[model samples]
Target: MEIDSYFIGQLASEEKMKEINPVLSNVKVNDSNQLQFFIEVNNGLDIPADYEKYFKNQVIRCFESNLNSSEWDDLSNKGRYFRDDQFLKFAKNKLFIFKVDVNDSLIGTRLNVTKNSLIVKEKPKNISSNNEKTLTTIPIFRDFNVNKFEKNILDSKSIGSYEYLQEIRSPYIVCGEYLYGEFKNFEKLNDGWHVEYEDQIKKIPIDFNKYKDDILITEHALYLDENFLYDTLIEQGLEKLGTIITKENKIYVKEIDNTTNDFIEEIISEHEFLSTYKSNLKAKNLVYDSKQIINFHTSIKTRKLVILSGPSGTGKTQLVFNYAESLGINNSKSQFNLIPVKPSWTEDSDLIGYLDTINNIYRPSETGLIDTLIEANNNTDNIYVICFDEMNLAKVEHYFSQFLSVLELQGNERKLSLYNKEFIGRVFNADRYPPEIPIRDNVFFVGTINQDESSNSIPDKVLDRCNLIELVTPENYIELWSKSISNSLYKNELKQENKVETVTRSMLNEWGDWHGENVLNNKEIEIIKQLSNLFNSTFTIGFRTLNHINSYLANLPKNQELDREEAFDLQIAQKITPKIRGNSEELEKVFDEENGIFKILSKYQFKISNQILRRKKKELDIYGYTY
Candidate 1:
């Protein structure tokens, strides 16, 4: 008995057979009970590469089973066997042979009269198609002979032969004298197959016969795929084509063709012009006087190093990060770095970089200060901020002395020596080899300190170089807590709106105009002169401190949140009083007899200054030191 062709097609369409081997292109059966199947090996289907062997064994089992048995009655058993039990069983008893052909290679296996099967032929062998060898060649052409078929086909055809090539499975086709195809996708262009379909042309990854004069041409109406063209432009280092952005499902490509410096200036200008003015620390939900915020900004502009010192829990570190966030830094490592000073640090290498003699590579400290400086050197247009949290944990003059000296130098003199030789390289990759790195002007450094037994005192040299801002815990706990909760809720709402903008250097310089007037009024100058006279060389005020005081006063907000006298008094308390600490009896002579307050030598008196001075006096009278 022979298996029916209809039964074979039904078996091929079964759900079970489709799941097991859907790539089977056709199935046939011979009078000798031999089953044959042709499956695609690489026809872009999801079939596995090794499916030929698995499908051949499954087809043999399907024919050997009894289809009309009780087990075969279940609908789930559709692909287990064909429905004709008599024919399949009779064919199985006689003999069962299965052959699979893939990519023109025939592989066969035979089942004995019993139920066992073995390989009838070992390795796969090439098979001939008609009288042709059917060797796989490049730029494959159609089988039609134009000379023979032109009389019938050409007369009736509306579209040209090249137009039909678009519907072919292969990506290439030869017609008349040229190879024609559409670019399925254009990833890159090299010396390979060149295709043309209509106006669209591309160089693909197929080979062509060197002897053929295949010239491809098309009308100029077609355009290359935008994504493919954009990628190719970038891969060729033609970045002047700029970037592509999608909004509302439409793509917009922006091209830039300016010099590097001009391009950076444009980006900075855009950021600054788009940014809205707000309090420096407003984003962090902290309520501080507007004058203090301006003063902080001015200090950063004037002096690159700023010190935030006060008691712990006064939001010192929070202030540093909040100021950076307000400038759109957001604590990104490329723009900002937070180095926690360790108690064990005693030398510059512990904070900057050191030579690993055993590895012969220079290793930057865990603080990443060297990496941050290197980045600043490479990107001069942008600003970089570094915060030293709890900086007093280490002796500042010892570990931070290198920065103190290097920062004072100008231009090329500001280079920091990291290794002894000029060819020192990093441990991981030697390509990044640098013996000295310049400390760029664009970087800003901030330090937060808490004075206690666990921390060391900041030396006078460190104090003289940087601006000092003092923060005390808020007196109104109830109001602070309530506002914190409300600000958090407000930020959540703001996040939903997704409003983001950048702040830039030029904007900062323009904003500094709020403090454009550097002149000091008579009363302000008198107050400074009195303070300097009263200190009497014991704690003499220098020109830097005087300049900083004038700058702070000039930069105060025009809204008059703090009166001139009040603002000057706050500066006196922060900039001068913090430096006035001693166990000498001469300091006691400056204290008031009645309230133990340090009396101002000038005729004009400030209540805030009196309070801060009295507090320092009490500390000096008892603990022998005042912070």
Candidate 2:
């Protein structure tokens, strides 16, 4: 058997071998043309008591000569050891054989060895200490030549390469056989890495340092070096090689997709719209309190119908107009339809479309209700708002009864019949008008109502179906005027069409689920139950009120600094208390100020003793009716 020269040299220089067996001496080349060393055990001679220790030292020396210093150091750190007897057993089995070759180049030297038919590459000298540390961590790609792979591509693609790939201006790295580079004018194909570059189908690589840009990567690609890529990009600037992260100590990085970007943009747009809407409201001298604004937005998001009911001259109509204008819906007749409620309206045809036999044509009312609904149905991407200015002037149950029932239906069930089915193509133009129009989720309704002798009272059915946001004029006239003047100047400089996009159904469902699961605690449910018990016979609430309350609490903007109980209090004041109206003695018992009914409903956390409810109760007691 041929022994390696390095192992033979280590055995020859080992003093422990000499001490353990004095007959064993220097190594020499044998006739077989192999490095030879011998050990002779004398008869009747006892070996040293620490013979095992000496043998172990020789085995370590052999390991030190053959293995790399880093490998030996790592093995030593791991507390690995081999007994002399173990080494002898390995040698007897012919397992100590190794074939190694050393080569030198102008750039650096390399040590190549064979183990189980796989070549073990030598450590490069050019690698920094930081990179060496990183290498130790990433064992999966320890044998991977990332630098050579990148260099080979750069060399091969230097000429006659695809123009789009060559035009990549930002430096990137390759991971998992996919190139991630930064380049402008790259067409986005999907939410993942699939792309069409220069009209050729290709897997578009993600941007290296420009991750915050419009580029996105596939989840499978991200998993390869998710943790190490961020640090590598930061350390090497934009041009460095992508480092392989150690698989053992995995770093988690969230993958970005088009859906995530869209969701983030939606949130940002909502915030921006809210800010601009507030500014516009101030510009128009319509000062809505924070609660009113929150409830208004929440109402639109959750229920799609909101009632602005308060005394006249409180800017209720102006609030609706300003809100629409802030959302870039300036065209009153197109995006928003203002229908004046007439006292003579007592049936569904008064508000909904009616068939006219005159001139052999089915004519819609001048209110443009059908046209607005048609526009909303066609353009589902935008938010369409309709305002019933002075809606209480007529009995809402008569003219708005169909809407009251139709709004309760969800999804595809939300449809309203315009006229007879035969009239669809014959009388009413089929191209522009259908027999029944589907009430889309994107359309929201707002009604400006007043409690007076001329207007009819809004019944419990209507009150329960909609969220009531009472508008009160600000008492601080000086501050209001100052804000209005400041906002008017700012409004003139801003773009006129700051339209806010409609939130998707998925987003609303997500918020609803999150709030129902996380935000609504047991204490709030108990409070709701107690409030329901207060109006036991008069106006006890069901799941509808509970759902509205939950949705209201869920849809409130995160930045709004309202406590949990305070938010619930606002829901009670807006959603629940608005429905409580009568001259019954039980009603008097619930609204009694001394009994603290409103306070109790709010869990005694915040006071809900607003003048809206008080005025309604006072009017109900005096006139036996209130809206």
Candidate 3:
């Protein structure tokens, strides 16, 4: 996952290919000025005899082919992210691999060999000045590997806020889009200029361990699971196949390193967590489907805060309490703290605490929520689940404002300010309760809101930060209850296999490029865009919701119990559909069968969300407002 896994190259026409390097005269181009991976042809023997099967995703992009005298141009835009003189001297080959950014329309990461990727090969020439001018044949097929090259490949400092880009670039990988200064780091190191960010994003935390020898626990560290690098080397006939993954896999961010997140993902995804959680729920006489458990887990990972809404007695609160227990977090005072929100609460002090300045003491809420946050900071390695029962009893925006603002800050910066910094020494338990309690990454905040007249409505800001899931009441409640009772006949009968274990903070952070191809492919992204447009007019939300949906999709179990499409269908239901609210008269056109909500629901194969909406439309008709 180094940044140099990609190279910035231009898509050439057949004629353009002939003009730059006539040795590839027989090569054909797919389309003009398109970006892709490619291969070269020389003497009708660029590839192995049976190359088609392996090289289907690659096209041919020589220096030039169809260029007229007036159309003279460089086949690759190598000047974009690098200094021409510096890059030319150190670059081993034109084919070097690089990493892809989350928001990259420009840079591509090394992954699958799907449709067409640009395969690049240089027509080899020996040093002619006082040296032999040996003609080197081209590689018919080549793959990519980030570990093929060493770090500080450019041997320079980063030019801007995307400073980490300088460290991950390597000389011997085929990083395709990197020539674009992003693909390339376009700013010259010596020039000392910085690129402006398109969005007003706060500068990302520096990857402090970029050069460290140790594989420290950090989100900035990249891991690539694809074998593109090995395949590329074989295609070029550069390496004998490796029978077993040895030091190579460990040194690179390849799979064998067995990252903590990878281990957690494998464990949960392989039915260890799923089966245990489902069993625990049933054993507790709770009736819920696998989809609900999956959605709940995905929501917890998508954002630390999860809002559960339903009519009374739908098991919203029980799910949170039971799921934590399945993970063996039975300690109510520490890792599991349930603070029942009082209905009359109206301010931040009601939830977090108060200054009590007259006595120069911080009186934390009796609920002990602050104590859990303090505990979270001390035990950063373990998870802390804090649930606000009846969270909607009071307006969430009032009591939870501090958390709403601070959770937006990432890593160690997320802190809840209790009082003035000067009061730390004056507070009763300065050592035990620091003035500012850091909301460590391991802390999970769950809220249960019973959707009755007693509860308050959640504002868009709260909805923006949290994934609000409205629990679907089972159609046949009596039957479900009977089944659950039968299933729980013996409390000790449930098998102890696949017992839930403590999940770490790393599992939450390393969900992997929500915006990139690794998580959701081009087809899925297209579907999201279509849905986004439809929701724009009626169900307005910001970029956070989109990203949460992607993360949720990325974290779905790899087991056949749930597919990506089905998980995404639930996400549209859980994340977007819950926000729909208005008078039935006003929303009638928006949910009309021909177009709008119903049309969008049917357009994509969102069967589950659509089913939920069917009841929603009916409820809106009878009750006038449905959420």
Candidate 4:
């Protein structure tokens, strides 16, 4: 049922006449009036002359016109005109013929006529005489039994005695050396049983003798039925074990000795600390779950840098402490370390390490915390984060500028080693690991900032590298606080726990281009004035706070559609004006109706501390009633 053969052949022409007439160019006329022009076809040449009419006249019109021309006048006189010949002359000076046949019958012929000419096919051989022979002659297995027909080996015409007689109808006979056959009538000697034939079948059994070492047994192999393997394993109830698959598809069953907490710790350690922070908050009911974004470490997979910031008394420190405890570090691991940062500690040596006075040992302080972070990680691949609380209390640019550069060197060869042991000029001589270690992909830096009276602004350079997420004060904070406190302590609990959870990075992003945007509104106008006063008193905050407020509100859902004008006004009103109210004379002199609200807001500078307000409270109270 396969393709026995496939090819092409000439299709017969129905036209009458030897020479093709100008009017009937497709017609061929021979001298005897037998008309036959070559027609191209595929498969066997079964196409008859009657099928020629099926070809449209338009198809042969070009050839027809050529025949009547002077150049083709001789061709017009030929017995038949063949498009195949013309096509052949137009192509290569040769043609291709694919002759195909099935069991000696001319099933088909494919003729690819080209420029010159070609032989279509070889004439088939006559094999009928060979078919008459009833003997096997293949040589590889040597299975032929030649002595089956000894009686047929007559006295007159016989080949060698060793050769069997193979019937042949041809007049010629093959030489004994060239002839092929089996010994006929050999089966008669063995009681009509062919011993050689039976031996050939025995030789065909499966061969496994070549493989010895890898074979487990020499016995019969167990053949598996359709579902035998599945059924056998299911009966043993192996599927009941509480096992989970690893990435490679290896199943690990839960073990009481290992405990769930152990696996949880592994999973936690593998994740960057900042990413875990967001998730931890949600789990602790501190923040909404939607804000939990997974942020992993870049090159240092073992470290995390989280910067937490909010207004004063927002409970950032407490939350961070809780976070540390939840990691089981506060009790179980001495590895957990907290270091307080001061605004005055201004140098890279302050954070990295510095030589101490007593014996000139490069003693570790906050810098020791950094050293501990590097030392504590059991696996270099795990992250170890240093949480810098109130990071902006000191100008980050002032204190950490050099440290930042060293960190940026990341995977480079920057080394820090101890100096002399006796003088106050050396790191510990304990050969305590080399310094300036490559900052791992897992180590992290988390800083907390209080966006209140005593902080400097975080620089844009710092923000660009961090994934800052704002912790927005949950809407349910009051309810949660109430539940956590007695009725007498409700007010204090609410005040202490209340906070706005928002990330500084996202806040800055929302401002777009605040410096180029428009003027401030009442709310923004007010906030700006307050911040200005606070800055003037202690040199604590600067224009940066104003910008930060603008940035923060810009991202809030409530602040959507805030054009440039609205954004500027909102920053001034909500963040700037309130701080200025602490000064009574300044407030009254500038904001009094006689001076005009917009004018005072635009030009006044009552920048001073909140303590000034208490001293002027009486004057402010009197002035307020007059207004």
Best by the TM-score measure: 3
Q: Candidates sorted by TM-score, descending order?
A: 3, 2, 1, 4
Error of 1 at 27 (Å): 99
lDDT of candidate 1 over 1-627, digit per residue (tens): 111000011122233446555754234443555444322211111122344343333433333222212222233234433434433333221211222222323564431111111111111121111211121111232223333222222233211222111122333333343333332421111111233234332222222223122211111011112233234422332233222211223334567666644544323321122112232333345655444555566567664478988888777787777667656775478788989999999999999878777877778888988888888888876678899999999999988988888765666788888776544443443345377788776788899999678889888888777777776654544565566466563454345222434566555555446433567888678767876776774677897678767767665544222455556777776678778777647576556464233434221234445666678777877887665
Tens digit of per-residue lDDT, candidate 2, span 136-165:
110011111344333323332211111112
Estimated TM-score for each candidate: 0.51, 0.53, 0.54, 0.32
TM-score of 3: 0.54
For lDDT, candidate 3 versus 4, the one ahead is 3
Two-way lDDT contest, 1 vs 3, winner:
3
For model 3, residues 1-627, the per-residue Cα lDDT tens digits are 112122222222345445544664322233563223333221121122333233233333222321211111222333333222332332233322122222213453223221112222231232111111121221110111122211222233322212223332321222221211112323423212223222111111123234122111111122121132224323322333212322233343455555645543432322334455676776666777666787788778655579898899889888998778766675447899988999888898998888877886778889888888887788886778998999989999998888898977777788888878977667776777677888876888899998789989898778878877878755555676686576453354344424556545654444333533346677667756766666565666566777777677766654323556567777777777777777876677667777666655542356667777887888887898876
lDDT, candidate 1, residue 202? 27
All predictions: root-mean-square deviation over Cα? 32.7, 27.0, 19.2, 36.4
lDDT (CA) per prediction: 0.50, 0.52, 0.53, 0.35
Candidate 4 Cα errors over 4 Å, as ranges: 1-304, 332-334, 356-360, 412-430, 433-435, 483-627
Candidate 2 all-Cα RMSD: 27.0
- Positional deviation of 79 in candidate 1, in angstroms? 99
